[model samples]
Target chain A: MAEKIKPPRIRVSRRIKKNKVFKVKVKFDHPSFTGLAMADDTTEPVFNRAKPVTFIRNMLVYYGDELVSRLSLSSGIADDPLFTFKLKATKEAPVKIVFIDNFGKRWEASKEIKFKG
Target chain B: MVGGLTIPLLSVIPSSNDAHGAVFQTPKDLENLTELERIHLPKISLPPVVEDGASASIVCSVDHPMDEDHYIKSIQIMNFADPIVIKGKFFLTPVNGEAYLSTQIRLSGGEGTVWVIAECNKHGKWAASKKVTVAAGGC
Candidate 1:
């Protein structure tokens, strides 16, 4: 089933030095469930067993056209996880992140790189 | 006759490296991890104590060069007690200013240790761990 997914919140450090590394922070709204939590013990079949696993499986980070980082995630991550990583902006470009979930859903967000003097 | 088969056989054989082009690898066993050089070890920073079942902030980084030829490949957070030992793994590139990551992880009930493993393309793997005490009840 298709569902609406809000774009991820992305924030890039302002006033970055030329050719210097800067920080990028991203937050996603996701359950990130490990599928280990049981919905109910009294039910004939546990509620969790019937439900499919839902979590972000892969993440890719890009600075402009160049691929910067890739991540393989698991259920160990908490709900609505926040991630912070470093990136060096050689040229002015958008820093984009794409996340793929177990259900084959893709969500992405980007922010323009603003350089400082 | 033998020469005719040679061409087909050579093409059928797959290359040793991955065809899909995976730049980094996850060490599954201790032997594979031991084979890597112990340089550029990761430094882990987190509170020494926390409330039970509370989310703890974790910051890890490696002081290494991010050159095209050599750089930190990935950073992994692990806990032996968790259902999945690897909490998360982040693969990196030269564009990343440095090998640094800041995130949060929830520790299981009770006190235990958490480990951070860093992998470098040229240098093998380096690891560091910290003990976190989870207070049973604070409310």
Candidate 2:
């Protein structure tokens, strides 16, 4: 990214609760520019085949080794996208979230937490 | 005139609604199969009214067993008004652990309908829809 942003932060609430549905919160600092506009318009040198892949198009969230949820996004999504979801609190598990932009670049993060029974 | 029998020209041409390659635009009168209805369910989740040129969300969640044995096969979305149907597909397995899906879509101004169909890997298919109204001169 041209502009540096803070790293993404993730938290799972009621981390130690058993049999309770887990709530996940994720936030990242970044500009999600859209590639659609730049895909067609190339008037300026800055956009010279810049390959407008500015916005994220796919997101995958996994609990443990299993894929639990995924989001298929587009330019319509806001910048620094925030997402929340629920997974039946199984035993202590590891979580991984991955984001992919239109240009085929991928960003991913993983977290490990403990659950109390 | 292969055997002196005149072949009707109309019979040789495929009907406009029966275009084979079209994934959308299913004809309402075809009687051979319910394949179209199978792909696009009978009912779906949609907002009663949506503003013009606004982003709309279509929910394809159906209450089904999400255990290792039973789960939704996949979710398919389509809109009859737009040319590109078969918008996207979300494949599901027990690993997903959730029985729901939501897809964000944009309408091309005015009234439009979006369809959702969820196929159960073990059970069958389910369908739903949403009706939208856009503001004047909006999409």
Candidate 3:
């Protein structure tokens, strides 16, 4: 029997205040595909490099329908990719974040925050 | 007789000797005026001076109140002392008489800090309110 595969996950957080700066962090978990190569009777490695495993993570901030900020994470292991960013929000808006891995896989998540008076 | 003698005494005042010396030949021409009256001439109102490493703010007000949809199209903050860019943004909104714009800035690659400058656009002109500086903590 073949083992099941799991998709990546994303997390987001922000302060609940109006017109205040807040920080956001994103993370991704790498999927294990080593067993699949063994079952196929192939010694070829799945990853191009000899590294154990790796994952790619990205962070973005959106205001009202516009992409206000973006940051890219490169050459990091799959343990967990974390990033921190600052933004000032004047109104209550939803922040969307997207994360993608090297295997052409993608995951997305979002968080909505309200500014306090 | 005192008034007649006063005129002769006033005539002894020295005047500028120029080609058109007759233009200012009387004692009245050499009379020293009050300092305030002499200095009160046409002048341009200059903005307040903000020192380096110091903070300042700018404010923009409109004749009429605007709704939440109103936003700042663009903004640019420049350091008058040098050719450094303090902050640049495309969208911002004002609330409670202020719009908070913060920048994660570093001076000559020293330590990273946050420089907060307030700004607003009224009618068609832009103005700044004040500046607030926040030192960098950790990553």
Candidate 4:
């Protein structure tokens, strides 16, 4: 019989963009294991232990091969973490975001928009 | 011989006395009464408050004609958005007849002003000094 390996989960979503400001949120729920332990005389207790987890969130903006801006956020939580900042982008350039989680997990995403003529 | 000596003595001395009596004009006898009066008068001038990226200097003068030593009380720097950045206390040194201070500040923000307050420590009493303001730059 083969054992199953559990993978860490991360959810990244775009929140809002208005007046040249961009905001994004990232969230993660750490994996945990439950075990039984003997305590006192005849009583047993259930112990829940969490695995080690660390994550870093970063947003990178590029114009051609040149990197223009970068913002990074790191946290440990079950809910989403958001970051908001302003960027001056024209129709010719696009912005990219990269989120790296613990256990060597990596996620890459990009967004492109045309300027109003 | 006796007659000539007595005549010479009488001629040298005034008989009843002149119109004005003997006037003493010695350097040691002269007293600084007017100068003493000026020393007790209070004369305190406040310094201008300096904003961030600006330079400010303050000069305080005292009329100590007798060169008496005194202390300054409650020197404060106010109107600072963040007081942690500007360093130093309010006490000053007695130099010449005055105390001079030159403080240069580099603030974090580009706007807002500050006021520098000073007071004289007269024993347990305090004499208030003038307030100076440093204006901020326009955005």
Judged by TM-score, which candidate is best? 1
DockQ (Cα-based) for each candidate: 0.30, 0.06, 0.02, 0.01
**What's the CA error at residue A58 for candidate 1, in Å?**
1.3
Clashing pairs in 4: none
Local error of candidate 2 at A115, Å? 3.1
lDDT of 4 at B81: 44
Model 1, runs deviating above 4 Å: A1-4, A38-52, B1-39, B52-54, B135-139
Instruction: Return whichever of 1 and 2 wins on DockQ.
Output: 1
Candidate 4, residues B1-139, lDDT tens digits: the string is 0011110111111111111222311112123324432332223332333352232332222333212356433233333443222222333322112322222222222343333333444433212223334454110
TM-score of each: 0.75, 0.59, 0.34, 0.27
lDDT of 2 by residue, B31-81 (tens): 452554433332345554545333454455555556778766676666565
- Model 4 residue A30 CA deviation (Å) reads 8.6
lDDT of 1 by residue, A46-86 (tens): 33443455778888898899888997887667666778889
lDDT minimum window of 10 residues, candidate 2 chain B: B1-10
lDDT of 1 at B74: 89
What is the Å distance of residue B27 in model 1 from its true position? 19
In order, what lDDT does every prediction score?
0.69, 0.53, 0.32, 0.30
Best by DockQ, which number? 1
List the lowest-lDDT window of 10 residues for candidate 4 chain B: B1-10
Estimate the TM-score for candidate 4. 0.27
